[model samples]
Target: MSLDYEEFNALFTQFERTAIHLEMRDSYGTAIELPHMAKWATGEPDDLAWLQDWCDLVREGTQAGKSFRRAHVIGEPLSDYQRWSHSIMQPHIDAGSEVRWVPRRLVSSIAFPGNDFWLFDDRLVVFHNYAGNGQIIDFVTSTEPADLRLCKAAFDAVWPLGIPHEQYKLD
Candidate 1:
């Protein structure tokens, strides 16, 4: 089924064991991040206030024995948005989310599902759809056997191939 933004964020607070997110896009058209993105363009250290809620959720979940992992598959010559996202992702990592970077070229052999997804506890899968220009479109959540298998297989194939956040450098 489809989920609105609030419903999407609510999953973080409810998953029983793990939250695995696979991000395939380099940019997100976010109004909430506009000022921060602009500041980043000028080489400023963007404020962390905007991210507090998510970070808190991650921190609390992890502290409660949940594992939160995110793998980002990005292309060469990172876009400005990628750089911004990389910088911002650290806070989530610090809050106990295991984040990794996988350069896209090396993973061509594996089949991708075209959209980004969040797999919760190996059960529910939420696919994130976006416009060509990076605008948020909608999210589809699934618990079908076939979909879970595909998502789990795809994620397992890519997760180990990713470099830890600290070791990955955008170039």
Candidate 2:
């Protein structure tokens, strides 16, 4: 039904070992990150060299066949950080990996109905309440194909409508 923070962490670590399909969506902010995600994605370090090494390891993991997919639908177009972060995945995309961009409205209409957003990793679903005090208040289901397919369909529909990166500059 639900797991505390330690349990959730262990489960995710296990998921990493098994190489399951991991999918997530989030709004842009510094406070909302899991400590590891924050450190890996946008962390400052005491030593620049160590930070670069960590970044290299992340890049290696990403290249070594991690099926990670994410979508961001901001109120407006992406901010500079969003753009940069999304751009960082270009090499993976070029290598024929599964990364995507879905319009936020379509995602809102489908997966995240009413309030809170959903994170679907194979079957483990985390429903986060955005309207609340910014905590991940619920862990709903695990690896439901029907629900995942529905969300994917919504993403597919919106993805085609997204302007390509080259065209983004023109906008």
Q: Which structure among the candidates has the greatest TM-score?
A: 1
Q: How many backbone clashes does candidate 1 have?
A: 0
Off by over 4 Å in 2: 9-12, 16-60, 77-121, 132-135, 163-171
Q: Per-residue CA lDDT of candidate 1, range 1-171, in tens? A: 999999999898889999898998878887677789889899888678889988898899989999999999988788888888888887998899999889999799998787899999999999998888788889999999988888888889999999999999866
Over 44-102, each residue of candidate 2 has an lDDT whose tens digit, in order, gives 43223323432453355556654444344543465454554464555544443344444
Candidate 1, after superposition: displacement of residue 49 in Å?
1.2
| Cα lDDT, all candidates | 0.89, 0.44
The TM-score of candidate 2 is: 0.48
Per-model TM against the reference: 0.95, 0.48
Segments of candidate 1 deviating more than 4 angstroms: none
Q: C-alpha displacement of 10 in model 1, angstroms?
A: 1.0
23 Cα displacement, candidate 1 (Å) = 0.6
